[model samples]
Target chain A: MATRVQAAPFDLAAELAGFGQGPKVGAVVTFTGVVRDDSGTLRHMEIEHYPGMTERAIAAIEAEAAARWNLVDSLIVHRYGKLAPGEAIMMVATAAPHRGDAFAAAEYLMDYLKSRAPFWKKEFTAEGAEWVAAKSDDESALTRW
Target chain B: MIDVLYFAWVRERIGLPKERLATSAATVAELVAELRSREDRYAAAFADLDALRVALDQELSSFDAPLAGVREVAFFPPMTGG
Candidate 1:
């Protein structure tokens, strides 16, 4: 398992090049989140995170997924800093002997990362910038696990 | 001394990112109360307890949790990360 908190953009292809390369690995699941300009006026987004806590929280989330799922490998890469529309925000990958475990663990990591992680987002637009509020749906997603 | 941190709007509202203060408060709630009484900026930042989340030494915690051994305390709105 691996977790990374960085300010630099990650190459998805490069990240998955040798990921989950194991004889027993049968399935791999990956998810990527990107910035979107839903309001049309969005210029960019600024992501802020607690340096020490961000790494610790992601590590703890990864450990929890490992404990709950039978997997061969897993990786979480989340980025912070200025990102324009369509820029990748984060990605999660999971590998397991079965598709079910890989899929479920990937989803679990996302749900926990949404609410448990320390990162916050600020949207910049032509008009102004505003901090993104936590969604009730995001918090409720944790109940699934 | 405890290092107090504010993030996002809390940081913006308070006009600073962090500070070191010697506090005698025993719980997170008491710390909030003390900060709220300090100035209008702090009061505005902590006006609604329900809107905030607290962390002790980088670990998620409750406002009622004891602060006996915590070296750092952070206050911010609910996380919106993914």
Candidate 2:
């Protein structure tokens, strides 16, 4: 049960080294998001987050996922500040006794993080910078759970 | 005085990140109305309420929520996190 909001990059191998180590734990699921330069003009992506509220919101979402999925352990690491294409933006990992629980919990965490978190992204391109807008499809995805 | 924060395009339009103001508005909507009346920039930023979101004391809340004891209020565009 951990949530980290930082500007520094995280090491995935180091993060997963000790994941799901408990005796009953049988599955560990991980998802990593990276900055994509889909338009081929991006210089960097600036991520801004509400300083005091981002962590709390993520923690609350993680708690909900834990309770709903009976998770053995979970972790969420989200980065702020500027990032280049191919850089890791964030990651979520879940540990559970069964693969279904682990997978579902990881997916749930990602879905909630997409819209409920207080972070915003602004992409800097060769032309200029523009703020990213929330996608209606992302909000609709929440109806599944 | 209550602290008012803005983010994303809201901050860009408002030309600042945060401000401390003395407000007597009863709810988030009233505060918004007051701000909207103050200047053209605020009016432009808050022109479309449906395109914006509000947070009270750092927690996501509704526009109609009361501001009885809230020390902070944040306004921003819809979140685009992941």
Q: List the residue pairs that clash in candidate 1.
A: none
lDDT string for model 2 (B1-82, tens) is 9999999999999999999999999999999999999999999999999999999999999999999999999999999888
What is each candidate's DockQ, to 2 decimals? Answer: 0.92, 0.91
List, residue by residue over A45-101, the lDDT tens digit for candidate 1. Answer: 999999999999999999999999999999999999999999999999999999999
The runs of at least 3 residues in candidate 2 whose Cα sits more than 4 Å from the true structure, single-residue gaps closed, are none
Candidate 1 chain A TM is 0.99
N/CA/C clash count, model 1: 0
RMSD (Å) per prediction: 0.6, 0.6
Chain B TM, per prediction: 0.98, 0.98
Where is the poorest 10-residue window by lDDT in model 1 chain A? A136-145
lDDT of 1 at B49: 92
Please provide TM-scores, in order, for all candidate models, with all chains considered together: 0.99, 0.99
Decoy 1 TM-score against native: 0.99
